[model samples]
Target chain A: MAFINYSAREINCKLVYYGPGLCGKTTNLKCIYERTANDAKGKMISLATETERTLFFDFLPLALGEIRGFKTRFHLYTVPGQVFYDASRKLILKGVDGVVFVADSQEERFEANIESIENLRDNLTEQGFDIAQLPWVIQYNKRDLPNAMPLEELREALNPTGKIPEFEAEASNGKGVFETLKALAKLVLAELKKGGK
Target chain B: MSLTPQLVLLEEDQRQILDVAERLVRDANAKAVYLVDKNGQLVAEAGELKGIDTTSLASLVAGNIAASGGLAKLIGEEEFPTHFHQGERDNVHITLVAQRIILAVIFDDRSSLGLVRLRVKKAGNKLSELFDAIFKRAESELGDNVESPFAEISEEDIDNLFSD
Candidate 1:
C-alpha cells in the first residue's frame, strides 16, 4: 500500500533489498548512497550491531528522477539477512513495492543463497503478494570474487522463471549495481501504470 | 462530519515555512529542522548531521501515523493529534499545525528540551497558517500536474547539499 499526498503531488513507495547473511544487500545501498549526489538521497541509516552485523535493517530514501511530473521517491530498505531474524524481515516487507534479492555469488554460500530465496518466496506469499506478479529482480553479487559461482548455475538455481531481470554485480566496485536498480525501477513504473491491482 | 474546505496556503506561505525553519535553526541554534505534513511527507528540512536519511524516516513516520490512526479507528476514537519521541541519543518533537499538518524537528543530545519545545510552539502556529493556505490552493488547482520538487535541484545543486 502507498500513502498519497494529493496536496504535495508526490507519491512515496517503499522498496526493500532482501537476501541471506553477508550477501551484499547492505553493500548495494552503501554504494548508492556514496554515488548519489547528497541532495538526491536522504540519510542512509544502517542499524547494525557492535560487531557491524545489521542488527535490524539498512534504510535509505532515494529520489529517482520524477515520473509523470510527480516526484517518485523510493524508500529503500534492507532486511537483516541472518536466518533467525526471519521475523524482522517479515516486518520490513510490509507495504513493500519491490524486492531486490542480492544473492552471494560465492560457491561456498550456495546453500545460503537457496535458503534466502526460499525465505523470500515464503515471506512474500505470506504478505499476500504473488511472487510471480510482483516487481522483482536478482543480482549475483560478489561477482569479482575468485570463488564466485558460475553465472549460468546461479541463474538456474535462483531464477528459473527467467522473467525478472538479473544482473551480475560486484557491489563493492559498483558493477551492474545501477543496472539492477534501474531494471526494478522500470518494472515498478510499469506496475503503477497498470494501476497496481 | 465537517466537509467544509479549509483555506489553502500559497507558495509564499510555503516559503514562510522554510524561513521559519532557518530562523529556528539559526536564532534558536538548534541541530536539524524538519517540517512534515500530518501524513509525514517531508516538506522541508535544513541543518547538519548528515546521514539522517529523511526518505525512509518520513515514510516510517507516516506509517507510524497510519498505524496509530488505524488503532484509533479500531477503538472508535478520534485521530491522535501529535506525538513525541525523545530518545537517549537524539530528540524528536512533532507538532500539529492547522489541525492537518505536522511539524517535527530532529535535534542532537546537547540541545535543551525547553529550547526545542519553545521554538516548535512558535513555528507550529506559523506553519499551521501556511499549511492552511496550501490546502486551499490544492483544492483550487486539484488537477494541475506539477513537476518533482527534486527536479528543480540539479546534480550540481545536489552535490553542493553535502559538499561540506
Candidate 2:
C-alpha cells in the first residue's frame, strides 16, 4: 500500500520485481542500486540464505527526487524466485503498488517463465489484487544471450493483452533497466492520483 | 479480501506519536525507537540513530514479523505479539501495535530490559490510540473525496525525476 505522510511531505510506494530463479530479478535491482547516486539510494538489504540466494526478499529504498515539493520514495523488493520459495513470494506481495515481471529471455526457460507468471497472478489474487487492474509491466531480461527468444514471441505468450508496457533488458549491463523502472513508477504515481482504489 | 486502506500520517498525528516515542526513549534510556508500518515502511523515529540504517531495519523487522506470524499459523496460534533479541551490548524489543504497526526499541547497557519493556508497554498503548484516531480520520476524509495534491502533477514532473 502507498503511504503518504503529509507531515513529512513524502510519498512512499512499493514496487516488486518478480521472476523465475536465476532470471535476473536481483540483477535488475542491483543495476539500479549501482547506477543511482549515493544520496538518492539507501542501503540495499538482501535477506538470503548462506549460499546467497534471496531467502525472503531484497529491499532497496530509493529517493526518486521530488514532485511538487513532496519527496517521492520507491521501495524496491525482489522475492526469492525458486519454486520452493512460493510461501515467501506470497508474503512479499502483501501491499505492492506495482510489479515488474522479469521474464528470462532464454528459450529453454520459457515454461518456467509461464509458470512464474501464473504464480504471480495467483499470489496477487490471493492478496485481493487483480492482475489485470494492477499497475504491471514485463521485462524480457537477458536479451544479450545467444539463446534469447524473439521479443514478439515472448510478448505473444506473456503479455497477450498488449496493453501493458514491456521492455527488453540485459540487466547485467544495465540495458533498459531505467526505462522499465521509469515506466512502472509513472504508472504507480498515476494510480495514486486515481486514489489507488 | 479487501483493499488495503491508504495510510496517511498527518502533522498532528505525527506530533502526538513522536512525543510518546521521545518520552519512551528518555524514560527507558534506549538507543532509538522506530515506528514502522507492518509493510516495512518507516513511519517515524526518535532518539540517537546516527549509524543505524533505519530503512533496512524497518524492512527486516517487517520480514521478521511476517515470517514469525507464518510460524504462528503453522502451530495453530493466532499471532505472536512481541519479539525480543538480546545482543551482547544492545537489545531490541518489537511489539505489534494497532495490528498495523510495529514498535521497535533499541537499547544497550544504559537501561535494563525490564525498564524498557515497561516504558514501551505504556507508550505503545498511547501510540496505538493516537494511530487509531488518525487512521479513522484519514479514511473518513478519503471517503469525502478530498483532492489529492498529486492530482495536479504533470507528466513532465514525473519524467524530470529520471532526467539526472
Best candidate (score: lDDT): 2
For candidate 1 chain A, the 10 contiguous residues with the lowest summed lDDT are A1-10
lDDT of 1 by residue, B1-164 (tens): 01222223334555677898888876445777876543335767777757765765665665555456556666888677567787878777766677655566777766777788888788777777766666675555422554324334344433332243
Off by over 4 Å in 2: B141-147
Which pairs of residues clash in candidate 2, taking residues 3 or more apart in a chain or in different chains? none
Candidate 2 structure quality by residue, lDDT tens digits, A17-57: 99999999889999999999999999999887999888999
Instruction: Give the runs in model 1 whose Cα sits over 4 Å from its true position.
Output: B1-56, B59-164
Backbone clash pairs in model 2 (N, Cα, C under 3 Å; residues 3+ apart or in different chains), count:
0
Compared with the true structure, what per-residue lDDT tens digits does model 1 show for residues A1-197? 33344355566666789999999999999999998888788888777899888877788887765544556677788989999887668767766778999999999999999999999999888867788888889999999999998998999999987877899999999998888887786666656545421
Candidate maximizing DockQ? 2
Q: Estimate TM-scores for all models.
A: 0.63, 0.96
